[model samples]
Every structure is written in C-alpha cells, then in structure tokens.
Target: MRVAILGVGLIGGSVGLAARQRLGAFVTGHDPDPEAMRVGLDVGALDAAGTLAEAVADADVAVVGAPVGRIPEVVEAVLRHAGPDTIVTDVGSAKGAIVAAVDDRRFVGGHPLAGAETAGVRHAREDLFAGAPWYLTPRSGSSGVVFERLTRFLAGLGARPQAIEAATHDRLMASISHVPHVIANVLVAQAAVVLADDGTLPATGPSFRDATRVAGANTTMWTDIYLANRDALVDRLDDVVHRLQTVRADLVAGDAAAIAGWNDAARADREALLAVGLAGGTAPSCELRVAVPNRPGVVADVALALGHAGINIHDMTLSPSDDERTGEVALWVDADGASRAAELVAGLGLRVEGAP
Candidate 1:
C-alpha cells in the first residue's frame, strides 16, 4: 500500500523511513521547502516528494507530520484527497484542535513519543522510532481497516501502538510531552537571564543538558503544542507552579527533610513507572516481533513475517543498536501462543529473541 506523508520534515521523513522498513510500503512526502525535499530524496527517506494531492492520491495511508499548528490545515487537506479506505493520521503534539478540524471517521490523531534535538529532513533517521510509543486516536464511527492497518504500520516501524481518545491524549500530552516542551522553553529563558548576569555561565551538566535539550527545538513548533492544548496545558501548568512554589518555600525555610522528601517521592514514582515500561517487551504489539536487518526494512520484515504466521500481535518494540546487522525484535503475544510465533520467526534465518 502506498503511504503519503505531508510536511517532509523530521516527522514526515521519519514516517517514510518507517514505511520502508515496516511495510515496504511505497513512501512519498510533500513539503514547501525544496531543500528539505532534496534532503529526503537524497537520503532515500522518500521515494518521491510531490504536491499534496499527488502524494495522497490512491494512498492507503496519508500522514501529516507537519508542525502542531499547521497540522489541522494539512490534515483537512489530506482528508479531502484520501482514497475511500485511506487511513489518515497526523503526528501533531497537541490533539484537541486538529481532531476538531478534521473529524472524519478515517482520521486518527497520532503522536509518536519520539524525536531528536534536530529539525528538518536532513536529520531524518530510520532509527528515530525504535522502541517508541506511537499513539493512535480514532474518531468515532471510523473504519476499522484503517485503524488495523495503522496498528500494523506502527508495529512494522518498531513502535508500540497506544490507542487513546483524542481528549485523553491531549490531557496526557499536556502533562508529559507538550507541557514539558513549554517548560523547557521557559527554563531556557530563565537560564539566559542568569547567564547574562555573569560573564561566564557554568557549564550545564547532564541533568540540565537533558532537561533543556528540547528547548532548542524550533519555537514555532512548540508554540503550537502550547496553544492547541491550552486548557489542559493550563491545568498542568498550575500543578507545576504549585510544586515549584513548594520547593521554593522549602528551600527558603532551609528544610532539608522537605527537600529530601520531594526528591525521594519523585524518584519512587519515576522508578515505578520505569519498571512497568521496561516490561512492555520492546514492541507495541506483544503478538509479533520484527527483525530489522541492521541497514533497513528491519521493521517491515518482522511485521510481514509475523503477519504470515497469523499471530495476533498486541504490541512491539525493537532494540536500539549502532550495528545495523544486530537489531533485536521484541514481540508481545500470549505465553500460550508464543512458541509457535517464535519458531516461525526463527525460521526466517534471523536471530529472533523475545522477553518470554
């Protein structure tokens, strides 16, 4: 099936790469930036870059990986052009606005929790989505075929499929991804003022570097996440403010126990979540695992192999590695049905490994 990706930036370029590896799906992208298009074509991230209509025409999936702000318009345009059975998706950070703009039953609001500090197609890499969670928010009365295809599509890309309602997705993102992006920007602004006060600023260590690394992402991109999820962001922002005030008050009081308590609680909560996340079996669908052949199509090969096995995959994630030949595929399937799936996959002559 052909897949069209509009925007052709990092996200759109990534969708192309994933389609290649997961489904061997024909991949095309659209972007006004000729240089970005050139980069995608040069790097082989896209089969071709063309006008929006051409990109989506007869495509099985039309994905809009544009900026959060531009997503609504881009998605609506794709909705108008999509084939009758085309599954349309957008990788916008904020959901409320875009979902409302394009409420067609064929549409699914997707936000893959993955990205690097870089922007543009030149930075596009097939490894970007390894082990990431690709969320899907289906509109009511939507065609299940599109959702099923997307689930497999995301699985083929080595990402876990997380189904969420649009409203819930927006609220969750405000607390996790969107709000953090805004806070990163605000913190960077604060750091700038502090740096200006001194001739030399202290080198930000790993913690600060990690915290603010995303702050350097395109401001125009972030502005959209903040605005589209404004209501939820505001709620999350208030909670953040309260926590900040409490921390400040504790510091002012010189209460070591209070500070320690805050740190201890945070560590406990985070560690607990990590423990569960670690067990997601490295793939979105637990039923199938894709063995990526270090160089490319690692994801697609795995998905197709599993599909051929007729295994009902729940979620999947692939292990990250620098060696293109040593990719690890993790499949999530029932313990009772796992051996058959594993044996069939191992027959492919790929080193098939699983959590069970």
Candidate 2:
C-alpha cells in the first residue's frame, strides 16, 4: 500500500513513520518546508515527494495532516489528485467544518488524540499514536468499506479507533481539549498580572503548574482551531462560566454543604470517567518474552527489526537474568498482530518464550 502525507510535521511525520515502519506501506511525504521534508526523510518517515499532486497520485491512502485552518483546502486538493479508490483522511482537531466540506464516500475525518507541546518532523516518533484514542468521523454518505479499512489501518498503528458524528466530536472536543486550553491561557494571564510587580510566583503547587501547562499554545494553530470551533467552544465556555458563578454564589452564601456536595459529586464523576477511559484504552494484546544479551542498541535492533517487518510493539519491558548476561524482553502487540510479531522477533535468532 502506498500512503501520501500532505504535511510532514509532527503528526504527519509520525503517521508516515508508523505506516512505513509498522504497516509496511510505501509512504510519501510533501510539505511546504524543505527542511521539514529533509528531516522526514532523514528520520525514515517517508520518501520525498516533489509536490502534493505527485504525493497523492497513485496512492492508496492520502492523509491530510495540515493545520486545522488549511485542512479543508488540503483535503480538496488531495481529492483532486487521489484515485477514486484512494481513501482520504485528515488529522485536524476540528472536524465538523472539514467533514461537511468534503462530500466524498472515501473521505473520513480523523483526530489522533496524541501530541506534545513540541512540533515538527524532527520531534516525530513512531509510538506517538500507540494506545492513543483516534476519533473517526465518517461523512454522511461514506462507504462502509472505506470506513472499515481506515479503522483497521488505525488499529494496526496501535491507535484505539472510536467512531463519532462530526458535530458530537466537535462539541466533546470543545469541552475536553479546546476549552481546557482556553482556561489554561486565562489562568496564566491572570497569574501574569498578579506576578507583574514582583516578577515571581512563589509557593505555586503542582495543580497550578498542571492547570497552566498549556497556557501559551502554538498561536497560529490554536487561533485557527479556536475560530473554527467557535460556536461549540463558546457554548462550553458559557457552561464553565455558569458553573463558576454557582460556586461564587455558594461561597457568598456560606453554603458549606452545597460546596461539599458539589465537590464530592464532581470527584466521583471524574473517577468514573477515568475508570471508563482506562478500560476502553486497554485493548486485548498478546505478550511475548524473548531472551537477549544485555547490551546497548540490542533493544533498538529488535525494535527496528520488527519495524522492518511491519509489526508494531504496543508495549515492552526488560528484566535481566541472575548473571546479568542475558535479559528477557516482554513485548506486547495487539492480539491480531501477535502471530506476525512473534514470527518477526523469532527470525532475529531470539528465543520466543510465550504462546503469543
């Protein structure tokens, strides 16, 4: 399978790397930045493509990993260049607008819930999507075959695929991802004002740091994201403001019981939500133990070997033997990919010690 990546930044590069390294796909990448394209090739993300048109031409799948603002345009271009059977998907955070714009059976809206504060192809890693939630929003008239194919492909990348409607995905993301980023910015702004005089924030705890971690995100990217999902984000922001108003009123009235009740309820709900997330993310996987010499780059060699064979390692741990001469590496892969994983690992002359 040949895969074309529109933008060779972090997410795009990671997708290319995983497709080539873990899915055995011929990956091609195109980016406006020549440096990014060079870095992508150097890191083994993909082969070079002269242009977007060339990248998508004859490709089985084209992933539009451009910024949120440019996604629709890029998707359109991909569609123009892509084969009729080529399945096109986007990694944009805001999906409603893109999904509505692309009226094609082969187009699927996807958002991989995995990233770091850092950006660019230089920072891309093949494991970025491992065990992460990848939301897919299929268009109204999307083909079932395309949807299933995309879902299975995402699973092969070790991402947990969840299907959701575009509108619902936007609203949920507004609450979970977008709004939190806004709140973080707000909190840090307020802190900056308070600390202006002394230029210090003493006695700040982990909670404060955690809350303000995403205070200043990528301005260009976030500006587009905020504007694209303005309506849903505004609705969620209003809800947050209303909740804050309620808390203020309770505090003014000295309603200790009310405050305590609200806190308890919120704590329980948060716990329940986390529990559900844990269970949903833990897919059935197979574990294989392999004996290896305790040496530098041994693990890397094993990983690269599997990568060359298109087998993804979901997780791994190493334990040394009594003499410290050899260690057992416990590797995990999705149950469906286990047989291939074991076969690939065993071909490296290591003793595979588990049924998986």
Candidate number with greatest TM-score: 2
Where does the lowest 10-residue lDDT sum fall in candidate 1?
281-290
- Reference-based lDDT, each prediction: 0.74, 0.83
Clashing pairs in 2: none
TM-score of model 2 (CA atoms):
0.79
Question: Which digits, one per residue and each the tens of the lDDT, describe model 2 over residues 1-356?
Answer: 89999999999999998998889999988998888888999999987666999999899888898989899999998898889999999999999999888887778899999999899999999999998878777654555457556766887787866666678879989999999999999998888898997888788899999999998899999999999999899999999999999999999999999999999999999999887666554457788888887655455556545544435455566777899888888877667667876777778788886745
- Model 2 error, position 250 (Å): 0.4
- Across residues 67-183, which tens digit of lDDT does each residue of candidate 1 receive? 788888888888888877888888887777777777676787788888887888888888787777776666554544455577778777877666666787788888878777778
Residue 123 deviation, candidate 2, in Å? Answer: 0.6
- The global Cα lDDT (0 to 1) of model 2 is 0.83
Highest lDDT: which candidate? 2
